[model samples]
Structure formats: structure tokens, C-alpha cells
Target: MLLEFVVEVPAEQVRSEVEKAYTVLQRTARVRGYRPGKAPRNILSHLYGGRVHADVAQRLVDATLNKALAEQSVQPLSQPAIAPAELRPDASFSYKARFEVRPEISGVKWEGFEVKRPSVKASDEMVDAEIAGLRRKHATLQSPDPERPAKVGDVATITFKLEIGGEFLDQKEQEVETELGSGHLFKEIDEALIGMNAGEHKDVRLTFPAQHQNPELRSKEGVFHVTLKDLRERIYPEVDDEFAKDCGEESLEALRASQRAKVEKELTQKASDAVAEQLVMEICKANPIPVPPSLVDQQAQLAERELLAAARRQGQRLDSNADLRARVRLDSEMKVRAGLLMAEIAKEKEVKVTEADIEKGYEELAEQSGKNVAKVKAEYRDPKKRELLIGMILEDKILDMIEAAAKITDAA
Candidate 1:
């Protein structure tokens, strides 16, 4: 429910606030003929009449709006939009405030839907890939033969100067080591780097992709002057008992077993998350409700903050991109809609997060963080944070219930 109404502060209340304001000015304002903090009310009002009346009117409007909202049982999602109006010393002040309220939802159908549950089984190839990734992380870098040209797997150490549209990119020569054909550099530059031996210098011209990370460089032609300094290749240790032991396993077979188990767990978790997201998507599609713009904006701001924090962690800048903000706002609206739909489903199903559920959540957080339950509880001392945790737990419970009641089918 959105409420739009006008309220007037009575003349007596206005006059009382004016007197209070005058009293404050009396102590703060200095008069030429009077001692400091001893100015009379009439003199103070005479000097600061308009300012006092404006301040008093603002205070009176805020107080009166609160009182009226309480009296009318109106719960606003955002701050009330008060219309601009003049405040006079002779009469009551009136203004209109418009705000939105939470909409009532009922009879949300969230269960008995058919959703494809992905069948995920860990394979030998997947386990091998995971193990290979682990090995790559522990691989040693060895200097390659200087006479040999750089290849796809070789890491080339280069000092490069970049120019876009004949303008130098940076003042200093930038040194970087990148694996050839890794897609980290522009395709043209990567290809040009390959077949270049040590002490080789080349000027490569290329156009940046339209979706380049830097908005200013996107779709722009650039020239890279690169000098190949050295070449290095990664050498992986042979997968044997020693490697297994290095990975904290007893033997090769034990390491393979552990890798397989880890792969299975990862696949299972991925499949579960996919199914849960699908369930929420279906529920939201089936039961469409109007989402308040204020809530959507709030969620968008939160999403923006989270995205900015993530970008900061990656040492990437995104604050200047309007496109990123628009994308975040769109994604946030979907998230807010899904959350509201889930809340309605929880309400309809009479599902609630119990104390035990919250305790279990705390235990899970503790286990993940390697902290004790007491420390976790202490960390979440804010009541609002605790309430948010409970809300998340309740949403999880609702998802579990829906998943249990859903008809599962294997995806093709």
C-alpha cells in the first residue's frame, strides 16, 4: 500500500516550536547592547525571525509527519517525499508526503512443480583435470632454451610499451611475464609474441575488443612495441608417491581417491545449487507480484557495494562504468523479486526458522571459519545482522522444502 496524504501542524504547536527556537538563539546570538548569551527573546526574534520560523517549521513537519504516520498505521518502505511549501509565522503549515508500504501476499504456489535435477557423476577425466590444476599450482618454472622461439606453453618475459592512437600508454616500460596463447593479451598481440625468440623486438598493431576491461580502450586500435627478454616453461612433478606425499596423501592411490572424492563433492554441490536456483526461478515465474521500486533501489545499492568490494579485491576498477551500474541494477531487481517471492512462499507454507536452525547456521559458519561458536555469536552481535542471518536460514529451509516436494527429472 502506498499512502499519499497531507498533514498540517497546528498554529499553537508552530508557535511553541518558534519560542523554543528563539530561546536557543537567545543563548547563541550576540547583541551589541547586551551581554553575551543574555539577549532578549524579542530582540533575537527580530534579528533571526525568518531563520527561526524556517527551522521551527521543518522540525514541526517532521514531528507531525511521524505522528500522522503512526496514527494512520502506515509503514513506509522509504523516506516520505515531502512537497515543498512555505512556512509563515501567522498560520499552520501543510505539506504532502508520499511513501510505499509492503504489499500483502497470499496463496503462493511454490511446490509440486517439475524441475530438472542435474545428474552429476564425477568421471576419471574430471578428477584428472582437478589433479592437474593442483599440480600446476605446485609446478616449478624452468628457464627455456634462449635459441628456441616462444611457444603456446612457454611463458615469455617481455618489456613492452603500449600506444593507443599514437599516444603512449604509460611513461615507464612495463615488464610482464605471460603464457603465450593464454588469452590474457589481445589475440593479435599473443600471436605476434609467439615465434619471437629472446632479444627479438616487434611492433604489433591490434584493435581492442568491444568488451575490453577498460572502457576507454574498448574497440580502439593500439600498437604494442614488445621486446622479448626471456622465455620460461612450467615443469610439473611426475604424479607418483612423492607427489602424493607432498599433497599430504599416503600414496598415489590415496591421492587419486581424495581427488575423486573432492570432485564428486564439488559436482554434487554445483548440481544442488543449479536445481535450487531453478526452483526459485520457477516459483518467481509462476507467482508474479509487483515489487516496490524503493526495495529494488535498495537492493541495487547493496549489489553495487558488493560488486565494488569484489572488484577492489581483484585490483580492478569499476566505479566509473555506467554500464556496470545498469547491469547491477537489473540483476538486483531480479534478486529482490526472487527474495520477495521466496518470502511469500515461506509465509504461505508456514515455514519458519527456529532457534535450533539459527544455532545450526552458527555452527556451520564456525566450522567454515574455524572459529568457535562463541566467537561467531560475538561477531554477529548486531540484532539486524542476526535477523538477516535468520532470514537467510528461513529461505534455505523454504528452498529445501520446495525441493523435497518437487518432481525431479534428469536433464538431457
Candidate 2:
């Protein structure tokens, strides 16, 4: 929705600006054969007339365009492109600026969209599994009973010396504690460790491919002399009163009730989120409106940054992937379009982000980040970050309104 925004400054205002610009320039501008503030108007015009006119024209445009836009209630998506217009004495000044504005949205079919709500409940088995997982997560390593052989699921501490291609890779044995079946050790070595008793030594062969990631191991045949120093088993605790107390619960019954409630709440939130997402997609499809290229570009940049950060975390590079970047740009365009639709929907429903919502948002951020409320507030003190937070709050409010107006069906 690019429109030409034209504004005409009266001749009197243009003359006033011209005089003001010259007055300021005359006070400080240096010229031959004349002291500052003592040069004649004609001389000053001859020396600095071009710069002064540009300055005055820019000043008049800046002073009047904002006022005109405010009076017309035109909100541009980004900065405007204004062609430089000449200013003449005893004549009016006018300039036309072009920029993207929100397209007029009409006939938006946004009500009573169909969505499916997943009906989820925590069963006894689910609760038991969850408690069992908790116990395993808190499990400890214990020495195996009867001094048996090392097997999968057991932690093995071993020392091994490697010789590759008729050369010793390590002058001394390397000691490492690795869990069997966890891929921490080489596949062949892990397989060789099974059914091995403590203090037993074995010799194994290994081959490295040319395309291997490590340069030292590439295209090499190797041998490993392994010694199993010890074997330990992972022991999970029993679900009793003592376990419940350790988990900050009064008893086993209380722990079960708490886990059931937590699981139920999680299911409810998931269903709500799914429904909202479906409704938003439907509404966006119903009303396809033109979105500004600048907004879409901003979204694409944000997506690219997020992708780069994720790649860095996994020790990978994504900058050279043109296809992925192109796909990201395509996805970002749709996100921008959907976001514009949601904002319009929010305006239509009179959905507002209140002070209470902001306070609640701050509190939730603090809880999620394990930081205090004051620190979270301080971190968002920058105007841009605070505005981003408010935008998120507004988005949530709009989604809630959409979900409330949707026709949701319960599903198993």
C-alpha cells in the first residue's frame, strides 16, 4: 500500500526558513575579505547559497511532513522516500513522499473457525512412568553385584593405547569413563567391551574412512589394546515415603497427586495453544492482505540470526546454505503476513495489552529465567526490548481472543 504523501509549505514559511538558515550560516561561516556575521547577503548567497537552500528545504519538509501525516492519520511501515524539491523565494514549497502503509482490511472472515482440541488425561500408568523417569534421572552409579562381566547399560572405566598404520598414536594409555551403548566409545570398542570381566585386556582392530571428520584418524587402520578397570551399574531408587520426602513431597500419595495435576495442566495448555494456532492460520488465509517488503525483510533477518545462533550451538555453519536461507526468507514472508493479520484482528476486537499484562509478563519471564523480578525488569529497560515485550503481550492477547471465538471440537 504505497501512497504519495504530499505537503505544501506556504510561501511565508519557506521565506522564514530561508532567512533563518542564512542568519545561522552568516554567524559562523568564514569568507575571504569579510569577518563572520559581517558578510553582505548577496556575498553570502554567492558563497554558500546552495548549502543553505538544501538545509532550509530539508528543515521545512521535516517540520511539515510529520504534522501533515498526523493530521491525516497515516502510519507508514518505514521511513519515507522524499524527492528533493527546490525552494524558491516568494514561492510556496511542496514535496511528495512515498512509503508503505497498512492496506485497508475488509471482509475478514475471522469468526467461528474450526479447531480440534486434544483430550488428554493422566492415567495411572503415565504417573508411574513419570515417577520412574524421575527416579532414573536421580539414579546413582553403584558397583555391580557378584563382580560380573561388563555389559550394555553399565558404565565402564577403561585405559587404552592406540597404534595406527604401524605408528603409535598415543605414547601412553588414555583413560576414559564411558557408558556402554551410549556411543561415547567407538562402535567396535563398545562391542568388544561386552561380556568382559574387570581387569581383563583385549585387542581390537579399527578402520577410519577417508571422509572422516577428524584429520588424524582419516583413512587409517588402527588397533586398540583395552583394559577394563571397573564396571558400575546404574541404580534407580524405590518409590517409597523416603523417595517422596526427597522429592519435596509429604508422602507418596501427595507426590502422585502433584504429578497428576502438573500433567493435566500441561495437556490443557498444549490443547489451548494448538487451537489458537489453527484459528490464526485460518484467519490469515481468509483475509490475504498486502504486507510491506520492509517488514518481511525484518522478519527474514531475525530468522537468519536465530538459525545462525542454533548452528553455532551445534558446532556447525549455515552461512553458505543458499537453499536454506531462501526457504527461511519464504517462511519469514508468510510469518510477516500472518502477523499483520493478527494485528488487524486485535485492533478489530479492541484487544489491548494492559499494565497488568506487562507485570504478569515480567513475572513469568523472571520465573522462566530463574532470575528475580527486579533483574528482569532492569534487563528490559531498553526501549526496544520493552517494546518487543509489549508486542509479545499484545500478540498473546490477540491469540486468546481468536481462540475464544473459535469453534473447537474435542478429540481423543
Candidate 3:
């Protein structure tokens, strides 16, 4: 770590440098029965002696090195290792500091990168399919005679006492509710409960699978004294005009019309999202650059926090270290790649975030969040936080620019 720089000092200023050290000694020196600054300079020197001289020497070295680095425009990555000239209380001071620096990157090309946008359109058939899904959602269920063992598409009610290591695990009485499908229990006590019959109690022992979605119970074993209380099959109601009126529509035709409009809006949003994704992916693929490791780590941390927050919202905990690491690694790499590609696009196009654009973005966000636009704006009043949000908005704008330039083909 060697810092080479040209140093210049006026002959008159040399005395001033020594004088500064003397001033420090006068203010800081402690003498017996004498106030620090009020003491005579001669008595202060005699009492404190070379200790003050050493303190002054250290200060002079620091100031000289700082000035030298600033004058030479040298940026050090770490604190400089300085070696000062011999200490002199009444003379000019000079020194050199050695340190590493960041390398200046150059000669990188920033032109002719291209990206593609996917073309999409909502079709009548798609709208019809969505309407059918809505109909299914509103379908009614009637209990059927339970003769056969429970299967998929059949709902079953069971009274189960779950235990692990001979300890009763199902402390709640109303434990076994409707099993939408196989192994729908909050805690997968055992898969043995599946296909169990009504009014039959069985001591079912099973091991928790390694691939269990709940990380805490993975690879653990538990036993359940389960009683199949009732079993019933699902019976969907007919999708007729009667069902349509039940859904708050005057007629089936009106229901279809409303569903069609809703589907169309959703499809439009999906299409825009697809276009944005395609554009950024194409741009990233075409222009490959080394992403900063620090940037990637930061993005990964952000993704982890977001995922953890989502889990908390759903009353779930991420207990497995492996699962957490996998999520962090995947999310970090994707965000870093996207960020690097977006930065390249912004640099090439000279894209900027305007205040008006941020305001418009705020309006859109407020609409999505079901909040007042002014309130949303007020939430982002902090300048640094507002700038971060503006940066995200501008990144979306960059993707839009690339999408606008792309030649799209309808893939629907």
C-alpha cells in the first residue's frame, strides 16, 4: 500500500504547521497547580515534556496525509499506513500514506443491446373459461351416502386424537375438520388418516415425510388415535339462471357480461406483466455484465425479509435452515440479475425519474392499495425512502421503454 503524491507547502506555512502542534500542546497539557491553557508555555513544556510533543506529532501526520490524499484525488479503500519524518516541534512536517484503491473500469461498450416483448390479448374463450371457474367457486355441496372409503373430491369429517411419543398431540377437541383433500391437516400427524372410514377408530402411526411443507415437522414421526366421524361426497349445483341470480346478477347473460369484463381486465394486467418480464429477460440475456457481489447480497437480504414477513402474515414459520438458504440464493440471484440488466438499460438510454412521474406512480400504487393518493404520497415524504421508491418506478419505466422498442408477436 504505497500512495505516491506531489506535496507542496509554502515556506511561510511551514512555521504555521509547527505552531498548530504548539497550540494543541498548550490547550491539552496538564501541569501541577496550573490551569491548562492559562499556564505559561515554558512551564507547560517543562511539566508535560515530550508526551505533548508526541501528541502534536501524531496530529500533524494525520492532517498532512489527509491533505495530500485530497490534493492528489486518491481514494483509499482502507486507512492509510503513514510514516512520518522525524519529529520536530518548530519545523515543517511531511509524510506519506500507503493504501489500496478501487480500480477504475473503462472501455465497456454500451450500445446495440436488444430485448423482446411478448404480445398477448384476451380472447372470448378465455373469458368464458374464467366465468366457468367463478361458477365452480359458488357451487353448493350436498352430503351423499357414505358407503365407500373417502377419496379425492370427497369431503370427510373425522375426530382424531394425535400423539407423538405417547404424548397426546391433539389438545383441541374440535380437531379434525373437513379434509379438502388428502393430508390437509395443519400438522401432518400421519397419512394413515387418508381413506379411513366413518365411526372407525384406528391407532395410526406414520413418519413425517422429508418433503413436508411445514419445516418444523419434517422427518418426525407421530401417532394418532383417529376416529372417522362422518364422510360425504361433494355435489356441485347446476350453473343455471337460478345460480346466476344467486350471484347478484339479474340474468345469466348479465353475469357472463360482468365476468367477461373482470376477466378482460385481469388478462390485460397479465399481458402487461408478461411484456415487462419478456423485455427485461431478453435485455439481461443479450447484455451480460458482472454484477456487483455487494448488490447481489443486499438484494438477497431484502428478498429474505420480504419472504419472512409474508410467512408471518400467514402465521407460518420458516424453521429449516436449508429451505431458508435455498430461497435466499434463488431470490438474490434473480434480483441481482434484474437489477444489473435494468441498470445497464438506464445507463444506455439515460433514463431518469421525474417528480411528476413519481406522483403518477404514487397514484397508481394508491389505487392498487385502496388508499388515498395524497396519503400514499405523505407516507413516502422521507427524501431517501422516496428516492428508493422513485428508483423502482424508474426501473419499471426502463422496462417499458425496452418493451416499446421490441417487435412483439401475439402468443395467445
lDDT of each: 0.84, 0.86, 0.67
Model 3 misplaced regions, further than 4 Å: 1-129, 140-151, 154-157, 169-174, 186-198, 209-218, 230-235, 311-334, 337-350
**Candidate 2 on 85-147: residue-level lDDT in tens?**
688867999999898887887656777888899876878987887798779787999898878
Spell out the clash pairs found in candidate 2.
none
Model 1 poorest 10 in a row by lDDT: 315-324
TM-score of every model?
A: 0.83, 0.69, 0.66
Between candidates 1 and 3, which one is better according to lDDT?
A: 1
How much does candidate 1 score in TM-score?
A: 0.83
What TM-score quantifies how close candidate 3 is to the native fold?
A: 0.66
Question: What are the runs in model 1 whose C-alpha is more than 4 Å off?
Answer: 26-49, 84-91, 145-147, 162-172, 206-223, 311-327, 345-350, 367-375
Task: Sort the predicted structures by lDDT, highest score first.
Answer: 2, 1, 3
Q: Write the per-residue lDDT of candidate 1 for residues 305-399, one digit (tens) a residue.
A: 89888888986656637888889887777777778878877777788888899999999999989999999999888999899899889889888
Error of 1 at 301 (Å): 2.3
Global local distance difference test of model 3:
0.67
Backbone clashes for every candidate come to 0, 0, 0
Off by over 4 Å in 2: 32-47, 87-91, 123-129, 142-233, 238-242, 249-257, 303-335, 349-397
